[model samples]
Target: MRIVRAGHLPPLLRLPDGHTKIPGVPVGPLLGIDATARFPEPELRLAPGSVLALYTDRSIERRDSDIRSDVERLQGSPALLGGGGPDDLADGLLRDVCHASPDRADDIALLLTEYAPPRR
Candidate 1:
């Protein structure tokens, strides 16, 4: 998969074996922030059953903690570490994020997906 972010966090990938990782993607400037800036599209391979998690910063960000650590905390939460379908995962994620966050003044956006190509 190729990814180009407009100042968004790097996507998280959960392997089939249940190992989750934040790929080392280059951070790019937000769209229109740099008129002449160029973003790189890095290619990474995804194995079947690997779920790709893309989310907004507000969902996990906090004034008391680093965003990366917050993500790591979420990575170890039941939401992402537990076994379940996409719906279950989504619900769990929301519950965990909202419950842990002190204030809820912004909306949370998340997209969890997996690649399931048709069997040949």
Candidate 2:
């Protein structure tokens, strides 16, 4: 799998045994500033049971929360680390984090996908 983020935090990847945060490369500047900016593409091989979680900054940002801690908490959550389908995991995460408060100032967007390489 390949991931590309212009100016966003890298997504999280959870394998059957453990989890890891994908690192982002040094890409070009934000759009509108440099029209000729270029970015390098990086690829990764996903295990059959690997689960990838992608989200926007709003999902983890809060008025009184540490971004790193919040991300770590989400990554270590039982619902995410536990065995389950992508939909269930996504729903659980959103329900736990997004709906925990009613004063969110930004929109929360999340996408979860499971990697299952085709049989040869």
Candidate 3:
């Protein structure tokens, strides 16, 4: 999976030119824009059963000793969380994260996409 495209979505925040998609890339914010500037480098690759896990810093923020436990709990319950698709999981995780932390200091965004063989 090449980094077909990745970036912030302009909604609650201000964006230059007010456009999410640039000419060459698809619809989304470029990874290094604004609040997204601190995000680590994006990585993409094609592999069997590849799962792309993305999350905002807020997802792991907690007074609890280990937030990974929270993440693992969610990961263990795919059906309970959402059974639609990559986009659905992404949306669900974002909603869940926000609900878990209503007063999140930073905007929370998470996307989990898996690279699977296309249906024949």
Encode model 3's per-residue lDDT on 1-120: one tens digit a residue.
434345532111111222111122243556556564433333344354444555554664555546556555445433323345566656665666666667777665656555577788
Per-residue lDDT of model 1, residues 1-120, tens digit only: 898888998788888877788887887889898889999899878887888888999999888989889888878877788767678888999999998995979989999988676699
Candidate 2: tens digits of C-alpha lDDT, residues 1-120: 767667665678888775655545444456566778776668867888888888877887776777877778777777787778898888788877865555887789998888988989
Q: Please, what is the whole-model Cα lDDT of each candidate in the order they appear? A: 0.85, 0.75, 0.46
| lDDT score of residue 72 within candidate 2 | 80
- Model 1 scores worst on lDDT over the 10 consecutive residues at 77-86
Model 3 local distance difference test score: 0.46
TM-score of every prediction relative to native: 0.90, 0.83, 0.45
Off by over 4 Å in 3: 1-51, 77-81, 118-120
Task: Name the top lDDT candidate.
Answer: 1
Strongest candidate by TM-score: 1
